[model samples]
Target: MRSLRLGMTAVLVGVASACSALGGDDTDPAADLAADLAAALSEHSLGDVPLGDEAQRTAFAELVAPLDEVPVVVDVVDVLEVEEEGRAEATLAWRWEVSDAAAWEYETTVALTQGGDGSTWVVAWSPDDLAPGLAEGETVGLRTLTPQRGDITGDGGAVLVTERPVLRYGLDKTKVEGTQVARSARRIARILDVDAAAYAERAEAMGAEAFVEAVVLREDDALDVLPAFRRVPGALAVRDTLPLAPTREFAATLLGRVGPATAEVVEESGGRIVAGDEVGLSGLQARYDEQLRGSPGTAVVARGADDVLRTLFEVPATDGADLVTTLSPDLQQRAEDALATLGAGAPAAALVAIRPSDGAVLATANGEGAAGADLAATGQYAPGSTFKVVSSLALLRSGLAVDDVVSCPATTVVDGRSFKNYDDYPSSALGDIPFVQAIAQSCNTALITNADRLDPSDLSAAAAALGLGVDHDLGFGVYFGQVPPAETETGAAADLIGQGTVLASPFAMATVASSVVEGRTVLPVLLPDHEVQQVAPQVPLTGREAGTLRGLMRAVVTTGSGRFLLDVPGEIGAKTGTAEYGEPGAAGDLPTHAWMIATRGDLAVAVFVETGVSGSQTAGPVLEAFLR
Candidate 1:
């Protein structure tokens, strides 16, 4: 018998020699030992290493079981340092691919003692040989942690959009009997104040056991009512926190909603968002999503099968920051209430209130059921007579005094197209009246007749003076207004009355009104913490121009279209607009876009009603309601 010490490399080199001596390769001991080691490492288990080895198998299994926990990928580097009748060494590399790419490479040395009979070698097995620093009872694991989302607050620290407790009432289709499912869905829908038929249709489409949410009500709102709902068959309730406003209709279009991230949003977020993560879906929430969603955390750990004991690596999650806004809950409620008074199926309407002193947007209320569009802040409609303020400023800059005599007529024609005053044009006001009285009466023909006094750029320049056409750097979507060059006399005549390619949002008109009171361009501010500011116009209103503009607007409220507010308590100044839109009717009367803008103290508001009959008749009452 010759003394033999063999390693994985030596076993391959001696295969032919050993095969000839033994007369067959199948019985070679080195080949058997090499096969055993390779198979054991590959399966992450101990084969027959020690003779009759029950203890060795148990210990090695414990260490390798953790690899499965973390799903470690292993690669054999090489085997070296084999000396006859001595020891051999093997190098192995392992990696947790879920975390990183680098592998942990280490060497395992095993001493081989030749059997006394000299035909075999026995491995001196130990649990530590499987991985460096790995103990007998250790295992690996992973934990994913998410950070808390940012809260959205309004003026005076009113939480406009924050996590609030709500009862999510729904039906689990699979839990209910087939005959009772529709009945149960309707019962739950009735309790939740949702459409019962819609809920039944939704429930029918879901797979068995699917949770079809009927409604989500505030915790306080449902607290007294939840018990009665719980008694309904197949009705299930789960309490969860959702980013919500005080009321369901409170600035819904402006604040938007937060829900599970969509596939498109997830892809756009790079690796920041995973499936099932909640993110802002619209309005300001969608605009400021990255800032609202904080960083996530990851950790790799090792523990016993029964207990968590150690952490190998960790990265802590960073919490999100708060988003403080300029909204006022009280004023927002009032704005919404005022818009609702127009009755159901009212044409699209909006009211926007701004603070002149600091340019903070106090309220933005779109009419109830505005078809999900942010009409209060983003809708594009003709400002109608509301645009007279810009024309007045342009007139004043051309040295026309508020007391300057400007003719007011029932109708005026320019470039073969007739522009007329609103229907039932007051016979008493159809004469040569002062400019201020012309504005008060919302004399459209008067402004149209005077279009030749200034260049087309003059109106745009005047509009820019009132923060209308210039970029304001507002963080959210807004159509300030647009004024193309009035190349033709007809185009200029239309521009004088805020028609023909001129469009403005309620928010933009509110800004225009505020600019007059502030004596400069007053840019609306929503996100105070955000660095963007409403860029000031190149040529803002002068102090004298602002004073004259304010005096003329006062005439509007005192004796013109906004005279409805004369009895109200506040010191109000206003301008009314009735822009003709759409094709002429059978009687050659065009539909009008009614508009009104008024200022009192630090507050300036703009109101609009598409398809309104007149500024005084349609938008005036809403303005009066808000002011009162």
Candidate 2:
């Protein structure tokens, strides 16, 4: 009886200890192994977990049995060759045929290490997605490839940016290579401002076969600083002709933009690269990309590991052709100055200047930020009083006398939409004003009241005649001024006042000024040699109407918003607009858009102050400085 009680006690103690081991919180070698197996078997729907021993496996099976509807299948398998720290790795692999014809395979890495008990445990496993080498009987290989860059130039064919020198660093990372290798690598990182551990680990992962880029530093900057890299025992420097650009934002819009090489270009060249091989994405560079890109010359050589030759490969590279644009430096500078003078009030304006004789675009300026691929020219906005110029021309063409009397009560409302003269000034519109005087003074009541006299279709046609709403191939982006609906006289009236759907680019307004100066329609162009043969009938303003509109425009420069821009000695004509439009219930006060269009001698100009209270005040000074 005593022996029987002792045996029973020993069995009870063994069972309790076994239960405790199964529930322990420390990472069980079995559980880790299970997770690793699952990752390797990801291609298969089911996964496997490691069991430390048959005893543990039995316990796990009993624990999972109640929850599983089907009997769980537990298998113990041994894998070879994978090592954690010089020991075999316990791993699992998956197989799933995507389709009968498609391939299905699993590849992965595993961790193996000997434990304190001298038993090897599978510590970890990588997913098949990140794994390698489970497919049957196939050879896979990879090669490094790089992009061919292109030369970037300025207005005068000045190669501000070019591909000059490329540097490659050779590193020896074998632990047997001595401590000097690691220490030297650390010094290189400190000098280059690169992460040291990252560089070291990359070397450890990729080894002697990898290449490190040293292309960012300029020729002078790199040459003067190369000594810092030379101290590394195994690191060697190689020069390669790579693409370079001098200016960061110098005419970024017109010149187009470039970026790093794409994978396809690298593959197409069979893993070899040509210097000065860049692709154009926008502006003249994009439009004439083919011509500018030019054909590549060939080079032949006995190569090194990289397939690049120390001297000329047999085929020399063909230089790309030069492209000349019509942009004028002096004019662009002047237009920019004009926008800045508009002040903080009008920070969202656009301006375009065009030469009527050749349709050459003198300059274009904007503050619309970026909308799609286009810049400011295509952005939407209210035209304000500047639009009234187009309306006045339409009315004059409709036989309304320039001297006709139009009584204005300082304020008028159309369709519950009320408007004030020039400003909310009561004194400005206290009395009767003449047709021409109304335009010169920019009287809202005078224009809006007379709005009914002009045909809606005629009004629409006139705006269209001025190129108000037309899509153009501007390379960047362009906006066409819009006409308000005519059904509502109120709508027509609003349109007459340069509000309600009317929007334009600084370039468009400049074209309008050019039309008046040349007595013919005009448009903006960026290239001197660009063709401009309009196939449609040219819209013409009657002689009397032209005379009247011209006189009013001239008066605006002499006495109104253009007063500040009178520095030009010759006859100059211009008009200004300050308009506002925003959601009815917005938080901060909405800004006003300021605008100014001027013509002097043969030169025509347009200016926009992004969001200024008054065009006359904001853009006038800028135009004056530029024209003078």
Candidate 3:
């Protein structure tokens, strides 16, 4: 035996990114903090080589006590290498770990030659460190690692995200000098949707020496989108998972994003991170980061500065758990389409559809033109006339008749505050409009007027019981709309018009529709089969009051603003609204919020088109189209 040693680096990971979520940035502007940390560790850590005394460990902590509170502190364990004998090379492992999270970990092995003891040290990419642990017999630790990922799934049990095999394509900075890497960065950027010019600048900034990760993709992955860079010189593409999700967006907000696992982060997890590890970023994945991120196995083999692969002791890889969602693809598409058409070209919009009879959101989607992903569920906006249903419920409960006269007005004062009808339409119609007509047409004056006479606290208590401005852990954001101020006339006016603080999501309006259909209050749920996973605290109105509100809502379809949808097949009830958003640069920038809430075929929904020109012209047709 020639006592042979070769430096071979192998990231033994053959799995796709599952729970991996991308952090804001890999190169954050925290270099000074890292430098100070590295300096403190150098001055105090490893003071006495082998820690034979119990006091030494505690003393080391004391030296870096100032830095410990800051969260990033570490010691230089060892500069590990693989020196081969007659073969001119050796095999070694470079282990890395993160001191935070204290629950996750990963490792990498390399085969290289002895460039003498301190000739050239291999500096890893971002988050990877150069420290090596004391080499125990037959076991050499390189870097610490961790991978954060969680379960994922689709409404119909379609597997969209899961752990699978992967092939890594890494670049050794030692072998390829400076310009030798520009082409790599350019090629990788084009492939990953990154800016090539920016990557080039960074590559140039790294100067002549330093390892940089240009790209990471599954093995044998085809460059389906960027065909120009396929099989280019100095390019490497290995075997990675066929982790496939049919839709590009794929409820991106809820399912989350994935990226590589870091060895430095694993020590914090008390786990291992192989190259195969990928963590989750948001929604379901983040909520279950621990359970979704499984412990990884290791194929420990030490290597030198060269680059070689060797096998020492190996632990078989482990797979992460699977997740299932309550998404209904077909319904979601239809709902999204309906909203887009109704928005009148507004940049942002959303639709939340649920089976009113139950509460399962059949399909939830944001329109293509929709601006900002506050998630329609979490977004707060003026409910406009759609909120009249609530005011009507209050009035009916307060012993008001459908035909009672309150004298409609173009502009009226309520509790000292002035309220105007839509576009300041005349107030004379008030005397004959009656309650049912006022509700059918979603009369703002009627609502504000009646709201004025009622107790503000009563509206608040009633709205609370109806699940307004409430939050729930449905794996999605849901904002409960605010009720108007009853104590003050201004609040009363704002409340009656669904303006002022009466902001809500499409989910809330749909709940109103559900309450009407189900004859009681209900929260919008995303559980399977529209099942009620959890009932948000709500105030259930009397069955009689609910029935009255339903009748008025039906009149909205029969002869009111939503009459255009009267021919909508099945027992469908709907209300149309054109809510005025504030002026430019003001909160809720859009000028009008066209709204239509309707139910048919077991579904209740709220459609919103921010700044839509007209409720009947815009949102009305959309509702009809969605149901058809």
Candidate 4:
């Protein structure tokens, strides 16, 4: 009986010890409640803590979820019994980092309730506990404020590209019947003058509710097309503004175009742009996109269930700067008109004009079928006999006089490769002739036979002096020609004739002609202050070299291939070129690229036609029109 009594005593003592460890009057219930709440808010997880009933806990967690996402730090200051039994009051300091623009801090009192066991306690939760003065049914949200994009201007402060009203018309696949998606896309494509079949396929591939854009037209241009879209089922149109030029084809290639930023562009932008922002696609618009796109502002806002919006903090957006270019609209229009006169179905062509004194690109235009391709400024083509100008400089520097005797043969072979004159080469002038006459006649044999007299560096250096085969940062898209090494005798012969990897763009050629007229390297400038300043030529043309080249070019106009320009006013000098390209033998019989370079008093121009038989017959007329 004594042993059993002792066992019972020990069992009671063990139970008391466990209970004291789990809960005791010495514990600060309010402090424990504050620690639990802070831990729960930090992890955004409620783990078996009873703020109220199960339903109440869920409701409280949902209410505080958004607030928990914000950076928060909490500290409990003190706790004291209130006037009511089993109820206590506690004070806490709540620190909230709202955003870069604002921060919030306040002291708030929370109501604590003791559990039925008296040792356990929990705060009577309310939205106000999270943030002082925050009421029920209110939530925080972040809003982005977009800024206005800037304008791209040209010379004389002419706005080249700006935010213009446009109608974005396309097919909404989800809104239309499954079978009607293709039909609707086709109709929209036809109305917009795009490829119908391609658009039909694109529409069928999109999501059911996706909007497949067909075309975006200027407000004025869309007026006539909008009436037709109404007849097509499932057709939808959104009126919006985009960066656009005066017309669809105005310097389309050099100025570029703007559209919804692509996934690639957005990814490249880091975090500056979201999914739906507009960005430049090509040309100058793309090159200076960041500068043209201004900084966006941010706003911290609060909203209620009734849809009332209250701004807690706001930052104003900054507008972008205006980009100015060195373009003359009048001359640009005239150049386009001259290209249009080439008639439809004409191969892609381009005309570039520059001011010889300042290297200002006055006018640039691509012909029919060349829009958006930048053929004038970026197209690389063989300069053909026009390259003889560079060869003339090299020969003059190599101790050959303008009146030096050079052989003009019907056919000359270099390294076992036979080179021939043009099919219409005057047979009477086939014998030995003055170097000047050979240049005027464009005698390929004369230059080919003399190729051994020059080295690859000799040609490269002279061409560099004329701005060919040299690199320049013009602030926009430009290919300043390329001169590959002519390691072999035959390669050197072809290089003398501007072939075998001698590539030149019309912009580069025009710069070369300008250099001769100015007696120095002409640096082309488009955008002021945005691009690298033009540097003086590393090896400028000497007065004697320029004078010699001028005399040779004038000979062509007075007695050679460019004789047609003799009657044109202010016609000082000119050179015509016809380059053979493609596979050798029968493939070479295809029409050659016609080219002409000319200089008037203050203007120097280069004209190119993709497939013309004769430079004098094809490019000469375009030059004449430009000069007139």
Ranking by lDDT: 4, 1, 3, 2
Greater-lDDT candidate between 2 and 4: 4
Q: Which regions in candidate 2 have their CA more than 4 angstroms from the true location?
A: 1-249, 263-277, 303-317, 337-349, 366-376, 422-429, 472-477, 528-538, 542-547, 584-589
Worst 10 contiguous positions by lDDT, candidate 4: 9-18
Q: For candidate 2, lDDT tens digit of each residue in 495-553?
A: 77777656776667776777667666656666544454442324654445545667878
Error of 1 at 552 (Å): 0.4
lDDT string for model 1 (222-329, tens) is 877678788887778888998888888899999889888899988998866878898989988888877877776666566766785676556666777778899999
Global CA lDDT computed for model 3: 0.57
For 272-332, candidate 3 gives per-residue lDDT tens digits of: 4445356654555655555577555444444433444344334444456566565676766
Local distance difference test, candidate 1: 0.78
Q: What are the TM-scores, per candidate, against the unseen true structure?
A: 0.78, 0.60, 0.65, 0.79
lDDT of 4 by residue, 320-349 (tens): 777788777777777888888789888889
Candidate that beats the other on TM-score, 1 or 3, i.e. the better one: 1
Off by over 4 Å in 3: 1-151, 154-193, 202-224, 235-239, 242-245, 261-276, 298-318, 339-345, 368-372, 415-417, 424-431, 527-539, 584-590
What's the best-to-worst order under TM-score?
A: 4, 1, 3, 2
Q: In lDDT terms, how accurate is model 4?
A: 0.79
lDDT of each: 0.78, 0.56, 0.57, 0.79
Clashes of 2: 45
